[model samples]
Target: MNDRKPNLRSVRELTPALEFCTIHGYRRAYRVAGSGPALLLIHGIGDNSTTWSTVQSQLAQRFTVVAPDLLGHGQSDKPRADYSVAAYANGMRDLLGVLDIEKVTVVGHSLGGGVAMQFAYQFPQLVDRLILIGAGGVTKDVNIALRVASLPMGGEALSLLRLPLVLPSVQAIGAVAGKLLGTTALGRDLPNALRILRDLPEPTATSAFTRTLRAVVDWRGQVVTMLDRCYLTESVPVQLIWGERDAVIPVSHARMAHAAMPGSQLEIFERSGHFPFHDDPDRFVEVVQRFIDSTEPAEYDQTALRQLLRTGVRERAISGTVDTKVAVLDAMGTDERSAT
Candidate 1:
């Protein structure tokens, strides 16, 4: 048997300190560590760079990991401005440019997954690979809670989060529920939900969260989907991971996305929930590292992308390989292509 001493340092100790930079006149906070191929980690809505704390340092051992708090979250500037997926994609490009980094293997979770896909679509030359975890922008079906939050007066309703003793009371309840239902999806997801609720007490954060939520979600469900353009990722290495019990963005979406994008890899955590990384970080890191080691970084070919765009994905239909369900869904909504 192989014997090795485990590194006993805390995750906070292993993680690099937050760094600041000015991009488009807004202060952005990010954590950077190690020196190798760049890996950009984008967190979900209502989350900050710290959400990746469990796996960031481990990934850093083999890659230059960059985790950023998207504008309006964490300590970043919360301006009354655009938070659309396309706009957030632009912000990522600008931030990377300011840091003098050219290309990255983009890894996104939840809402951040939408932004990562947009980034790859808008700036293909800057992306090496795409990794999505419990990502949005896959289907119109989302959690009813997100749909409710996107409704009118949703921002006003969030004021209830600020009531005195609300946070502590919820935390107490969550602690007890977590023990009783530890293996259930609700229990697996409660801690992260509580973390998000904790941030809602701040007026600016609440406002930013509401605006960001409404940008991609609505009372009906998700307003954006990348399935129509998923064919373009044929030239990019793609890996998708999801928890089988994911309540926020159903696991079926992962299977659907894998079907839409050819040659993509998919992994499902049997006992996890929305946050697979938090649920099984060691496996998460192993899967990521193995994928990175096995695949070559995609080289963006502008001429090829132009040709693909010109021809459109209709060729898949002629080849009898098109997913009819995806086609029907694509036809249902007008794709709001990213600008910039």
Candidate 2:
């Protein structure tokens, strides 16, 4: 007998694997791959667990990787209600509960980062460590256009009625905009930005882009404040991964987060952009693995773990076998520019 690889269909196919255990009310689709201690991965807006494919593959060798699609995004059900960060966090908590995972290191990106912060704050006992990659919840001032686009009327503004043949116009404008925009303004390197946009899944009526925008705009300050309080109370070890060229949520936010959570570690990816994982998976995995190794529970079987985490546990954090240099921002600095 042979076991065929699971068919990679639409995002919805991921649900059956993840819903292996009962999560009451919310049907969150998830998948558990590799073997070892559990590591829960939550993705940001407009992305699914597939985004973590590379990192998950590497980490799975060391731990049982549980990656879930947030309610509205991947294969999970999208309800017809305003999505709040708190709700998303709660959903994750329930997902873990049903999956029989009492405690695990939680990793989140962009919007998912905010969700992870909320979860760690709300259920500190359940979270061993927190890893945030370009997470949100710092400020309201996002991209000026995104800010405008998120408004109630903004969605209408994007329709072809406002600008006939808008999609074509957007493509043309994006081309010229790329030329005019600097690295600091484009959010990512021109090539990377183009790649990200080009690679975005083809839009369907149910794409959830607008819904994600609403969540991004609405889910703000309150969650961060709660996370700050969590840091003060629990002080769970935090690992922050940031891209130097990320303009969507500036690296300045990481500085603020480090100050707010004194115990947190910050790693800035130089010459990298918004989606650092896409640009440099090895470095991302290195830093995350270090944080996990630093905080792994003693109860877990070490010898078994060695088999799980393929690479040596003591390998360099940001660099693997070869040296990879990076410019880091000192959290303790008063001058933010000098720090970054």
Candidate 3:
């Protein structure tokens, strides 16, 4: 059994104040560093705010970076509660409201990508720009690995795999079992699952992951997609960063998304995998910084929201469909409760 401790050199940037706040009575942890336009870095499932450790500080240098450990991950309180994308999105909005932050560049990775989109969709007024890193909500095609993890009894198995004492042996046995299984779906994803579990060896976090997984995925694949409602983006700029070899959510999703979003920029990390930012931190930083510098943040308006909602039907009459910047203002009457 490999009992090696995970190399966390990349995630040691919590030097910034690790703050705590309560949202809907659930205590959540977050790290805010640097100062500039607000940048909210949302991590993926089975992961926490530390997932952005590699790039958060660098981004902080230019932008106010706020990295939160979502409700059921990291140092945040994990309650047996709703793990749906909408719920997570709403939570994000409440967190920002607690801080009095009105707008931000919402950057999300993997499951975080789904959350980012939902946040943008649910509150286009709060997002200045939408950045998706190997995001999951653009398509229904997800790795069989996550789909299986979201199934019945899968949560129990996931918890066992992530147990601190059992993980090393589990990884060893899983590796051997994977070898015996050949090139099967389990073979491909078991290694990833084992690696992730080894890094995140907390039962509560693992449980939250499984619950979050079941929320967005199923045996068939991802259950939610952003394509149908992309037109809501309207004037907000969208940028996509994807690893060429992403196995969790194929890079094809990025390609398809870029095509759908005519002007949106897509940067493919040549040799990267699911965690492109981790795989090539320098490039990841470079691309995102450039994106922030070159683009303008989106501002929300009820009149615009009302107008943007009509774009699809309007575009169909002329061209096709489109997207939003999530910023909640008093100008948007009657939507205050929903936005906040």
Candidate 4:
């Protein structure tokens, strides 16, 4: 057995500060830092506030960085109830109400991105600006790898036995076997899960794990419905940041977002994966700062700014579609035409 420690560069930068809030009939934990316009930081699936440590630290100089460990992940509670984007958004709503922060700039990544979009839709008055990083709300295009992970038999091998309903003896055996060989294989498809378990604060690991899994399967339906239409009623200064190499939620989703919200500004980073902040923290910081700095740009020049929206609409207009199978596999019914 390889007993060497996992190479974790992400958690090293995290400065965790705890806060308690109730969500889904359970007390949840979150981390808060800095002070300015309330900036609620949301994380992707299988990750916690720690994933935003690098980006949050940079933004803290200009905004209050509020990164929460979503319900059932990180230090939060993990109940047996099904989870969904609406649940996560409601969890956020409860958190914000408890904090007494009326309006905020919500930044969500991956699953958190989907949650952020819903939050904006449900509580438009509470959100001042929106930033979605490789977000998954607007498009039904999900990674094949993640879809595979959702299957009963295809999940992490240890998860097969560690189920909340499983026998203790079987779970124990699976835990031992999992510690030996299961995690490595699971990490190949679910990178963030491996990262979450390794970086989990304490006893919260097991529950958070279960909750995250439940959230994934439950959130798909409602989120897909929300994405079919443009949710924001008023212009709220939307910004999108996508990784060119994102395998989890392809950058194609950004294109969909641009099409849906024609006013949003999109930034695509080549060579970055699911978590572009990990790939290039400095560049991420720069892009976000630029967006915030130029927020007050001339209102009359909206057309020029709209033209600069980088969610790949112009590119899509040219290329049309990458692969028809992507649409069929995602089950996102839409007009399909082959690229010339």
What TM-score does model 4 achieve against the real structure?
A: 0.70
Tell me the deviation in Å of residue 10 in model 3: 19
Task: State the displacement of the C-alpha of residue 280, model 2, in Å, after optimal TM-score superposition.
Answer: 1.1
What's the number of clashes in each of the models?
Answer: 0, 5, 15, 1
Overall lDDT per candidate, in order of appearance? 0.86, 0.62, 0.76, 0.64
Q: Model 2 over residues 1-340: C-alpha lDDT tens digits?
A: 6575543323332222444333555456777776567788988766777778767767776677899877766666666644667777788888887777888888888888888877775666687788888887754435555566566775455443234455455567777777677555373545443433442333331335566676556322121322223233224678888888787778866766655554578899987777788779999888888887786542433454344335421212222112111222122221211100
lDDT of 4 by residue, 1-340 (tens): 9776553223323344677877546887877766667889898776878888677767766667789988767777766554677777888898998898988888899888878888876666687788899887555457664555455544444354444544455445555554665323322223444455344334345444545544454323212533333423225788889888776677877766655563778888876767878778999989877887777422323454344433323323221244533442243354321111
Q: Which of the two candidates, 2 or 4, achieves a greater lDDT against the reference?
A: 4
54-121 per-residue lDDT for model 3 (tens digits): 78877876678899998998889988999988999989998999988999999999989888988988
List per-candidate RMSD values in Å: 3.9, 10.2, 9.4, 10.3
Per-residue alpha-carbon lDDT of model 1 for 200-306, expressed as tens digits?
Answer: 87999999999999988998788878877888898999999999988899887887777777689999999999999999999999999999999999998989999
How far off is residue 153 in model 4, in Å? 3.8
Q: Which of candidates 1 and 3 reaches a greater lDDT?
A: 1
The TM-score obtained by model 2 is: 0.70
lDDT comparing candidate 3 with the true structure: 0.76
How high is each candidate's TM-score? 0.90, 0.70, 0.81, 0.70
Q: Estimate candidate 1's alpha-carbon lDDT, on a 0 to 1 scale.
A: 0.86
Ranked candidates, highest TM-score first: 1, 3, 2, 4
Which regions in candidate 3 have their CA more than 4 angstroms from the true location? 1-14, 162-165, 172-195, 199-201, 311-340
Which sections of candidate 4 miss by over 4 Å?
Answer: 1-16, 22-25, 154-193, 197-226, 231-234, 296-340
Residue pair clashes in candidate 2: 18-30, 61-308, 61-309, 62-308, 62-309
lDDT of 2 at 134: 83
Q: Look at candidate 2 and tell me the lDDT of residue 314.
A: 22
